[model samples]
Target: MRVTFGRHKHPRFETYTLHNGIDIDAPLDAPVNAVHDGTVAFADQFLGYGLMVILDHGGKNHTLYAHLAEARVQPGQHVSAGDVLGTVGASSVEGPGVYFELRSQGKPQDPLEWLAREGH
Candidate 1:
């Protein structure tokens, strides 16, 4: 849940951007897991996101997983925290890393603030 930049060269800033990005070290084709309970609302190829997954956590809250090498879930899927949703990818415009976003009521929000201490 902690927002650690997937690539140190590209630090996802908060002052200019509302989203938080990070890298998952599961390796090439490593399994990706959901950080919390949510329903898959979008599962498709996004612009700079490449293969992406969006989960609606309900109550006007959502989580987005992008730049994946492989996606294992589908739209409308109900996933729990720690559920395997996809695999790590190496073809993101942001480089070989996972791009994460937390949205509130369809608007962008900071993922670092929502993550509990000792976040994964």
Candidate 2:
């Protein structure tokens, strides 16, 4: 499942380091949709991630979507892939863009593996 964004800029310029997942270059206000079916485990601001959403896919697997312009989901809410969870935006003064990640067993993991395995 390929995620889409609008002329999105990569977050490589930002100092905040991200763990894993696809980083789409979506301009501010672009709609950010879910990449997979899961439950919203976290939907709020963090020190670096800014406005973000974390979805739990069960079996200790989860995904983190960050640097959002707006968050539409909430903790404990269920969401499926392609579900619009928020809008991409400049969450930090550092710059504008998204920094996504994937995790397993409470640790960050390579999103490329999951994405490739799942044929995204």
Candidate 3:
């Protein structure tokens, strides 16, 4: 996990609340993969999120991929762990990298804990 969830000061906001996910540095257009088996729930441009993809891992668990250069999967498409979902990119609001999050019931969880448990 590169950037963790926490308070941050922003030039415009004065004080930014928290990061919803971890940021992983990657080259522009580098492939982004799924961490678990799931179906693509969303794939489109989201406000402030840039190009993004959201995968539903069942049990209300989900993974979000942001700042993507391109989305490879579509809604309802089944994907397995390690399957490529998109390529990393940077928008005006962010830099070249992938913003990742693991959520259960819509609540963000520590990705390192989850990755470690999964033997990543």
Candidate 4:
């Protein structure tokens, strides 16, 4: 759970800040997959995140993928579990990896909890 959600001191900034996601250590351009069946909610560049994709998994649960090399799905597209959504990319600060997050009813949830539940 690298960079787990919540407040922590920034490595570069030297100040406490909220980190809203986990950074997975994947090589650049490695395929990134959807953890559950969902509809693509957003796929575009976001400040600080680089290229990003958000999946709406219903029940108000959404998953986020950031620092993507490319986004393969479009907004409103349906995706199944294991579907490739993009490839990992380098972020300005995080370097080569994928930043992931889960949210339920607009509140952040620990992705490690989800991953553990799924036996990933």
- The local distance difference test score of each candidate is 0.76, 0.78, 0.88, 0.90
Candidate 3 vs 4: which has more lDDT = 4
- Evaluate model 1: give its lDDT: 0.76
Deviation (Å) of 48 in candidate 4: 1.2
lDDT of candidate 3 over 1-120, digit per residue (tens): 457765567779687778778888888999999999999999999998899999999999999999899999999999999999999889625468888888999898888788989998
Over the full model, what C-alpha lDDT does candidate 2 score relative to the true structure?
Answer: 0.78
**Stretch of 10 with least lDDT, candidate 2:** 1-10
Q: Which candidate is the best by TM-score?
A: 4
Residues 1-120 of candidate 4 have per-residue lDDT tens digits of 356777898679899987777888888889999999999999999998899999999999999999999999999999999999999898747578899999999998888888999988
Q: Model 1 — TM-score against the truth?
A: 0.76
The parts of candidate 3 lying over 4 Å away from their true place are 8-16, 92-94
Off by over 4 Å in 1: 1-26, 117-120
| Model 3 error, position 102 (Å) | 1.2
Candidate 4: worst-modelled 10 consecutive residues by lDDT: 1-10
Winning candidate number (lDDT): 4
List CA RMSD, all candidates.
4.6, 6.1, 2.1, 1.8
TM-score of 4: 0.90
Q: How does model 4 fare in lDDT?
A: 0.90
TM-scores of the models, in the given order?
0.76, 0.76, 0.89, 0.90
Evaluate residue 20 in candidate 3 and report its C-alpha lDDT on the 0 to 100 scale.
73
The model with the greater lDDT, 1 or 2, is 2
Q: What tens-digit string does per-residue lDDT give for candidate 1 at 21-99?
A: 5544446677888989999999999887789999988899888888788999999989999999998897764446677
